[model samples]
Target chain A: MPVTKMIEPILPVEKLTYLENFGHSLRAASYLYKPSSADEIFDVFKVAKQNHLTVTLRGAGRSYNDAALNGAGIIMDLTRMNKILDWNPETGMITVEPGVTLEKLWQHVLPDGWWPPVVSGTMTTTLGGCLGMNIHGKNNYRMGPIGEHVQEFTALLPTGAVMTCSPEKNGDLFYSMISGMGMLGVFTSITLKMKRVYSGLLRVKAYPVSNLHNHLNEIFLAAPDHDYTVGWLDATAGGSGMGRGQIHAAKYLHEGEDPDPQKTLRVEYQTLPATMFGFFPKASIHYFMTPFFNNPGVKLVNTAKYIAGLRKGEHLQSHAAFHFLLDYVPNWELGYGKNGLIQYQSFLPKETAEATWNEILTISQKKGMPSYLGVTKRHRPDKFLLSHAVDGFSLALDFKITIGSRDKMYAMLQDFDRIVLQAGGRFYFAKNSETSSETALQFLGEETVKRFKALKHRTDPDNLLESNLYRRVFGS
Target chain B: MPSTNRNSATPLKPGKCAIIVGSAKGLGGALARKLAREGFVLGLVDRNSELLVQLCAEINAGNVGQAFPYVQDVTSYEEVPALFQKILVDLGGLDTFIYVAGILLPTTPTTYDFEKDRLMISVNALGALAWFNVVAPVFQALHSGHIVGISSVAGDRGRVGNPGYNSSKAALTTYLEALRNRLSRYGVHVLTVKPGFMDTDMLKSSPRTFWVVSPEQAAEDVYKALRQRRQTIYTLGRWGWIMFIIRHVPSVIFRRLSL
Candidate 1:
């Protein structure tokens, strides 16, 4: 789609994906810009701001769970503004456009023996998205979210004004913007602090946990000290004193563990087509595409797969493979079919961990609804305006929308809110759907919300960049 | 129960208690839909508020029977018991406990990307336990209940991708096996699932390897397996023999094999 041709139908498209912050997935209407100059990037946002359309800035669509989605207006996809503006090899710091992917950043820095300090679960997500989300990596307990790694950056507010801010300069905007859930503005570029790397090989340790309690103990034990650690739970197993089902811990490896550090480190992962990839989230792909029962197909492949698994483990990386991983699994969302999907992530105080997990499970057991990727992790408190992290544990889950049950899901969520509020937990701004005013009231309180309201009034008074989240929480 | 409409309008089947851990969406979402159709009340738990809200809206329209959603970290052991009690107090009992809450980490080799492994271990391993830690006592107190777990067939053995996932699943299956053994004495049904591939977001977002089943189909299969009290069943069925061999393969050979 040529930029000029694609720009015509910007408003009428019905399938827009609204992100959490000011951005949206208006790919259908928004023209893909391949700007040869930064001036052009600014021009895109300027035109949208002047046209009275909602404007959002986006990097690689990696701001998970709609943090990067906005539908009421134009989305300025910064993916094209990826240029390395500056680099300090000695300081291990680099400044680049908001569109530069962490993977792309590594390509340049890794050769010089450096690496980005923080990263998300996957590599395909963009550096700008990382900043905008202020993502927390596996080593967060030790390093904090991605925001702590940056020196400064540029964000363009809805007024078409670009501001360069950092901890020392425009600190309020800096704090509010990084993990601001993309509410403040769009990031044009960032100067991120990178970590020095050695062998680039990651030496790992896996612990088998019997149950949730043990997992938490191990997680926190590793949290204050370990360089990198995370824990996964087997939500399916329910029994007394059941431990060892968990595999929890990892640390970067040193030299000679892998025969060739350079080769292993640099190997790029190219995603295979859906035909070869088994875990794609498409309903048709999983349901109709298979000749046998879905479970049976998975089982049938297990024996042959067991052998294949060992063959791949021998390979290690001096540098992590990023684009190759995503490239191999292109457009995997087709598997979800047309109904689309939803991902939910939230946190609760560590003290309430036991009551919360049990309550959810007990409810799930009664409901007979089982989520696919049940994940659990710990987090330290974060100061980002509306960042999801608190001084407790967090969990993220995936869900698929069906033909006629969205309402049921909504009702269930309301009660869940009561329990979370009772536990003194708040919804992650990046991941919530419809938090009741009552629940929102509890978290934000009338006074805090009033203050934020005052701030929002001062900054985006027109509510120029509106979103589903904004309407649900702020009633903007 | 006899007159309950397990269809589009009144999606739940009455009398069946369901605990949907990751019931926020996809297979879990579809499972909730099916269970609701069967007249079963749902206890939906998810990290995504949007989906949870959407779910509540879908079920609460026209003043249908009520359901409560608990925003929780299923992996937190202490929270599990109270959750069980609340569900019992609110909905009155525990008939089924399904751990569906999960986050998809990109399926990559564990050695190179330790984060992926750590995540797989945590979500698949500890997250699964979040349900068990809470429910083990509830079912034991009740003296009889069903524990239906969504264990992936990937856990059967290591594959070319995501050994972390595979290991987590395998460990989950093993733990479930042990749990089933312990629970069987008290008349509890422990049914473990090895779904090959389901048309869920995780599958959609990742590279496609298997022709997946719709969440409805997967949910239907799971429901049947739970009702029949099958100790272990392959979701797609085709993956059964493969996993059977993988499960029994010698440790040396297994370790030598590529995941």
Candidate 2:
């Protein structure tokens, strides 16, 4: 007798652990499916619909919190669906699958004298994730969020219908999906307009400032002329040196001045060894600096970094090297130990940015929860329904989570949220891990939240698309 | 083919040209499509003529680059040189040659069948060598080109699951290493790609599949490695460390473990 073989579906449901955006917290999903194509994703939605289970789409799992995690249902991991669908060099238009990372996109296009119009600090994030968050780069003040570069996209709705959306077609859905945080649907493909660059080199200049006022002034003055501008703040700097930092400004070098042609066109992605940060051992830093989660130790380290920045006045850098400085030290977050870290970013209007930032720094100093890392960038408003941008500035802070300071950290963040709300500021959902739904409602205005909720109800009527972040922030 | 300089600011006129064996399906087919999108004229060769013609039609439909199909069995070692000559002549030139044809036999050391073992050796080991014998000399004459061979991580160490398949890959790996050693002085690059478990037809029946990557992911990794001119790479890259640890395990302890 011969045995009869049974063939199973390519993607099978399996139990998996889900990590929050910052990797500080984790949960388990009842079922997880890693689909390699849009059709497979459609099957996943079908299964979710049939089983009456919610579905959450995850891409590269880089959202600092619960944006891509679903505690009670299924997770569709889209990392494997990465593919460059098409590229039209003459029009400077490129089409890519949702799973393609920014690093991959840049590498593919840079050699052809083209580049993405907007890119966030980390290059590992997926293009789909960037669109979901509507991420802003250092050049946000000049270029706006990544959504502005998007020409059109094909999205798979929860009802298993695929629709092509653009600014001119399906305009309502297009607006909602840009910053809808994946509540709208899953994007299968996106076509973006790319910017032309003569070379990958950037002419960089660093200006050190003493306080928040000086930092803002320098950024304001530098924004008009520079293509990219950002500030690195020393959160532990107190008293006379409050909010002190360095403002780094950069622009692409002209064709003739780009030093090495081979390097400028075909620059290889460079990575550091796990133990090496520049020449120093990162493991030694983690071991020796474990006890420095305190105010004074953090202050000393920040001061050292500030002095180092001051010494590096002017230099030429690869765009990747300049934009992805945080990734240079591999597993640097391990320095925070097992508890992980939390990142909180708030966007305030230009009129109230300086005052709100001063109060926020003062609050952090009083609470003695000095952020280990801080960055500030200018921005302008966009048309996305859940847009986080304002004609102002955003301050992002990273706090190391420790056993003793966890509660204090949450309380401090709550206080910060209150201050931000009082100043008419909004929060970035991509970086938030612990914001309450009430706070989220206030951060996004009541009317805007209502409109987004109504759109979600219409698009995902059965509410099949769900995530932990969605539950916490939208009360769904 | 066009003489495209990747480093130049000027765009490629007709783009680079590539010859990919076993491109009718699976990883090879995926790579062919990707290279086509990257503006590469393609020479797609496979034993399955039906799939080969269909794939060529699909790639040609895009009109990004022209796709030429050749039906030839890799195991027919003597026909490889002639096939290569035909592809080069049809495509005008070749800048990249990728060999992705290989067979996996279900033969353990104890239950091995002679025919399966022989077929595995012929397709997985000799077939790659046959292609290399023809392509390497042309690349050396041209003084500029890249050759990529898709081996497997299973070659890193011999195990009980399938000794014949593992040994064939081990042979391919060493052959590619020797080619790399000899070709570097001539500016001809040889890259050996050792992929972990990829979700391809070969692994459809395997029960112990873990950390399996999609074929598209494998193709993407291969393209990136070729761009960087890496000597060797592990697709889904973590497999490099996994194989490193597996290869360094003490023999006495390794014998007792089930792989």
Candidate 3:
């Protein structure tokens, strides 16, 4: 028998391990390769192709869905390649390998008076993951997504081509690949323009909103003056209290506002405290919070939070303290227990934001599976082909899952997708786990899907790159 | 028990050494006989020392090929590496390896025996992986060999009768498929055997059975599949279509059936 020549025995059975999404709900048994350089990543791709296996790209594996899982295939984990290649504090320009995290980036440039232009709610996310999903922050309405700040990038294509893309050169690829969700190629290097900061502290303000209408109106109007604006809604509230929440808006201090900039800018002063109340380790807070993971328990907490916000306050908060509330209690997601949790986030135009969300919140409460936490952010549209943003507002709801409630939760989320699509809304792939292929087609349209497929054909004719998310959202 | 050479005057084919795991009784012993009849130098491994000695004596009486018996429990995964190397050295060189070691504990819809389930999985699933991991690199270096794994048709669907057995077989079936996909390019053949009902001690106490075959007949079928280098086979063949339908039955309906 004439056998086809295969790559050498580089992938061993011992390399088999489980790769799970940030939510821990989606996972796969994959052959994991932690590559430290572009050449090593290429070797992994070669091995995957030779063995007729698909390769999924992973950077910190922070996606909440199946975006980073390739079941029974190969996963190229690029976190080992973390390296800050170049930095220019004078011009606020920096170049880095794909694996560098927001925590590393901020730590590297805070003393130089520069900050990442856009960052996720958690500081542990990688730059590659941020760009792959085109993540946005509370300032999305003004700053767009992280991809908008990327000046240029170089990627290793499955076709064995090292291509450099920018707005002026290979602009089509530059736009699409950023939001391609790691299907186009593996990013080797990325150049970005960081926002210059005068101080390490942000002036903050907090207040309460009465209902869904007030919540949308306040954020839409406040986004222009504030550098960051976010809202926390009570998903269990209903009947005149629907979408009732509190909004926190923050703005950067001017050069002269912070009298002790030198002291505040120091990494030690800006880092989050490791312990709470000077004694309790923050790592174990999740265990204490686990008792309140149920609907009735969470409702009480949300009510207490809303009542506390009614006091109305303003104060200067450290940049890290203001941006990384999700990191306050380490492994807080574990509070939801073994089944984990899922976030269903939808972006709707300003015209239908209030009504659509009102219906969603009411239905969830009626079903007795209300979300534990609801976060709202203002967003403006972007140029990425697979863009999830809209010229309106986005609401993300986190629901606790149990073995008895999993199937019902998924069915309810599908209903939410229907309502969002009917209102001309879009969804962020990184957040939602249960969106069907038809929902994706409805949101992205036939023209954009065709164009994406054409690009995939040119870059990877053999179709060697795939993920559980890709197959779920776009048909196999 | 000690390793004994039978038909020492018979000259074995070059590189025709084979090892039959669980080769003391039932399907394993029958397959060993078939391979010996085909002029292979055989290594027989099993935990039942008395049965191992008896089977070795029976094969030695044929005086056609050689047999070497090694007493081993497949569940002792830690001992697999050294024993595998010893078998390779004792037989000179290995061209084929068949892992048929498995256990079926009594289970019903109402029973949830963690001890029994854990033992079955450890022996049937993880044991195959431990031995196969050692065998894979050797065959990859040689760029040619045969790996036969005995899975089961019970893995085709999730039945309520035997959750642990079904899951273990499902894990083995999927692992064998991955091995076949990876090793085929190196000219190494990996065959997955999914047998239906068999008239052996493992299933003799069951009340209802269908399409049951004798151990000798099943062994012949497996030998033919190895010779033909088939990727997967269902001994008695009809189980393939039966499983194809069973696998497609909607879960809501399938769950209501006793099966």
Candidate 4:
């Protein structure tokens, strides 16, 4: 058999010094290939294999960490391969190339009264990234993660085998690739079961909660009736007001119930205004916010947000506006400065969520490094091999990176891991940057880790598909 | 011209039916692929019958949209009206008509060739006008359609390096503007696309070009501009400001600089 059928000349590998992720963490990669088609993807894999270079697949580079970055190796940028392969309105099945972003998918399908079953906080993230991380949304409790709605997918394995896998076909590979973080292969195409929608508006209600107990209680109470439920926790809240925040519950409006007179089935999704954050220099904003990155300033901002949420209790919003809250303030992460930011999201079982969440908050407050933003969401356990959900609640906290906060943040994360592991909780890989191998092994359990390792070995025996994240977490 | 019913009960899919001129290769081909992927039943026109047939087969195999190839050169101005009418009938209706058929001949002020200049002007300017003459009335009759013309940033000002190509693009841009002004009253949109240095075969031999975007990037910008109902756009966007400054330069200074 021919080792390679060279269609396009493999461009000379160039050194890229600053492959900065969304969170502003920079890494180096030896080569970057923007393959525009499936055949090109296969060629990329072959070239990587020939050169004995580990390949890391990147879609949109929105992972906030090293998940999409590979130090001194090839980075396969899949954004150019964006194309919708097929759409069947009768069955609500849409087949799309892996590079299609959620925004583009919504733009194509929403006009046809179809919506993605699950959408992450930002619409810029690609389908491939969602599948790789097995991302969950606010409605995860109802619709599950993106992987659950994925009917099938075709991936180019490191062995140069193009396999179509689904729940009914190539079942083992299907499960492995769902949350495999693109270790098993590069996804070429995905067939998703898009949910049908009657209108583009969402009816949302917000309630202010006092403490961790109230937050958990409100989420549990809202979960049964709401299609989507999520809460913004005030991390700076201490003592009596600890975990005080607002819980937002929403559902898609019926066909005729939308308040907008101009409402149509084909609503155009609005992008964030360029002037939304004002015309301040990004670096200057970061510098100004550095002093306010502490407990008191964050508390005041959270308090104001709480009051604003209370004032706007019930309202109608476009589906895009409701789901993509992060996009409203363009470059919001720039406020965290050049050192970047790290998000640590931990999921704990419902039985121990209240106490463990309190402990986590207390540790941050005591360290004087309280998180700037905290969000809570309910999740149901999924069957994917490396699933992060646990039929419980997950608290995601964002901490700014300061001059000497790396060691402090790592030390604090270690403490968090100990508490979470003791409480039978686990960490999310999408937002993780400093998770240790031992912590990951302990959190994932030995049997599951061993099984994943065996599968990884079978798919990539030569370790062709490797990333810095893979080495840090899995220790391959 | 066949008149499409404006009040038909069938809902308007955003980009249902599109006709792409010069759909055989480069930026035109990229746009054809993108529109098809976005669920537009396409009428692909090109002089290269073989490549057009291959593209149609590939698009059909992908199952994104139906592609119908029309192997008529745009230079044949008399054939465009009948060909467009046939395409409209075959595709059921029209929603978008993108004229991307253009040529760039290497003719400087000192080495001006009459044959090359005529070919460039006919293909890039008059050919676009031929398609617009046919398609604009159809879109007006329907009162709901997008007419896009791919002009060039070189159209912003004439340069000595390639005067023929620049003037041709300038004429196409002005024609598109006139069309937009006339079509606006009937709810029809006209977008003039001005792209800078794109990494296409057309620019393969061009030296020292900055901010070169891929055809895919240019195609994406074109699609976005269409969706936004923009009057005119610079693909990869920054070229707008670059051209703005270049257009405002004094003749004394401009004559001294070799762009």
The docking category that best describes candidate 2 is incorrect
Tens-digit lDDT string for candidate 1 (B1-259)? 0101111111111234577888878878888877777666667877777888788678766344445577766545455554554454344345788876555577554446777777777777787876686676556644667887788877776676776777888888899999998889978899988787777777865765666777888889988998898898887887898777777988888777764
lDDT at position B11, candidate 1: 12
Compose the digit string of candidate 3's lDDT tens values, residues A45-93.
Answer: 8887766667889988878787887654678899987999999989989
The alpha-carbon RMSD values of the candidates against the true structure, listed in the order shown, are 25.1, 20.4, 18.0, 19.7
TM-score of each: 0.55, 0.62, 0.68, 0.62
Clashing pairs in 3: none
> How well is each residue in A1-476 modelled by candidate 1, as lDDT tens digits?
11211112222323232233211211112222334345775575555455444445566665433334342245566777778999898989899987788767877776565778887656667777777667886676677888887899987665557889998998777877786545566677789888876545565455555566776677778676556666554443445522213434555555555455565444242122344455654333444533422223433443333334323122232335321332333443333444444455557888887667667655643554433334667788776665567778776644444545456655666667777878877676555544645676677568766655565555555545443344345552
Candidate 2 per-residue C-alpha lDDT over B1-259 given as tens digits, one digit per residue, 9 for 90 to 100:
1111111100112246789988999999999999988878888999999999999899889956668899889877767765665565345457899999988967544686777777888888988888887778666655668999999998888898888788899999999999999989989899999999899999975768889999999999999999999999998799999999999999999888878
Task: For candidate 4, write residues B1-259 as lDDT tens digits.
Answer: 1111111101112226789999899999999889888877889999999999999898889855778899988877767755765565456457789999888877555796878878889899988988887777656655668999999998989887888888899999999999989999989999999999898888865766889999998999999999999999998799999899999999889987888
The number of clashing residue pairs in each candidate reads 190, 4, 0, 0
Candidate 2 lDDT tens digits, A1-476: 13323222222323433234545443333356889877888898887776556778888777777788664357888889799999987888999999999989988888777889999878889999999989889999999999999999999888778889999999989988989998889999999999988777788999799999998888888999999999999998988899899999999877777666566677463333445545777555656655765667788888998988776588877788888876665455667666777788999998899999898888887887888788999888989999889888999998777657765777788888899999989888888777778899887878998998898878888888877677767772
Once fitted onto the true fold, the runs of candidate 3 whose alpha carbons sit more than 4 angstroms away are: A1-10, B1-259
Question: Can you list each candidate's DockQ?
Answer: 0.01, 0.01, 0.02, 0.01
Better of 3 and 4 by TM-score: 3
Residue pairs whose backbone atoms clash in candidate 4: none
* TM-score (C-alpha, index-matched) for candidate 2: 0.62
B-chain TM-score, every candidate?
0.84, 0.94, 0.94, 0.93
The TM-score that candidate 4 achieves is: 0.62
